[model samples]
Target: MSQETAEPGIEASAKTAEIEALKDTFRNVPGLAGAPMIMAPALAETFATHQHELGVRVHPDLAVKKFIAPFRGPRDAFNPSGDYGAIDTPATPIPVLPNMREYTPHELEVIVGQLRDMGVVNDPEPPRDVAHVVTD
Candidate 1:
């Protein structure tokens, strides 16, 4: 005898449809260009968490180059002006942090704290090391 698999319930179907509709709405929204279409709340949280973590992991040199170099004025004492100073700055080659494994317990706690403040995570405890979560 052959058995048939159970179909999804009405609620499940409705939820899926709602998620799809939300995705479509997000796609048409302005100023959200190139943003990933994440349908699940858990997935979005994970993505945001990772993004913030990576932001914290950015090398100091690269951060300076990208965020500071553009607005930097000329190095002259008077009314010096130009991109010359920015261009003359030596590039520091630093190895990028690959993952959370490189972060210390304190670092993880700080990241978790920031995430909590931004409402990305609701954990009441602080994160300890890479694996441990801080408890009150």
Candidate 2:
């Protein structure tokens, strides 16, 4: 099976979570030394260099938590981070971790690069906001 089978088709995935829950989960990881994931290349690079302070932060469960944290909020369309989201409300797309959707050119490029580095494959026509790159 291709990478698409396990992840999303881009235009068909997206979900939301609770703010308090998300904040709590990350606060409770055991060996929270480094960043398990980074949306920005600069941050990822910084944490990569300082692996001690940010060690293994993204375990399977925590990884999923971090992925959904950005989506916790109102039930309207709104982008959490102007850098990672597009248009107005990002609630819909933001909640959909590991899904797909219409991402800005920059976001797409950066995410695509990260996906490649993380051993994740690219799904051409990803379902809307149900897509994200994950490590195997």
Candidate with the greatest lDDT versus the true structure: 1
Model 1 C-alpha lDDT per residue in residues 44-69, reported as the tens digit of each score = 34544455445422233443322112
Off by over 4 Å in 1: 1-98, 124-136
Model 1 TM-score?
0.22
TM-score of model 2 (CA atoms): 0.19
| Global lDDT scores for all candidate models | 0.46, 0.41
Clashes of each: 2, 31
lDDT measured at residue 59 in model 1 versus the true structure, 0 to 100? 35
The weakest ten consecutive residues by lDDT in model 2 span 13-22
lDDT of 1: 0.46
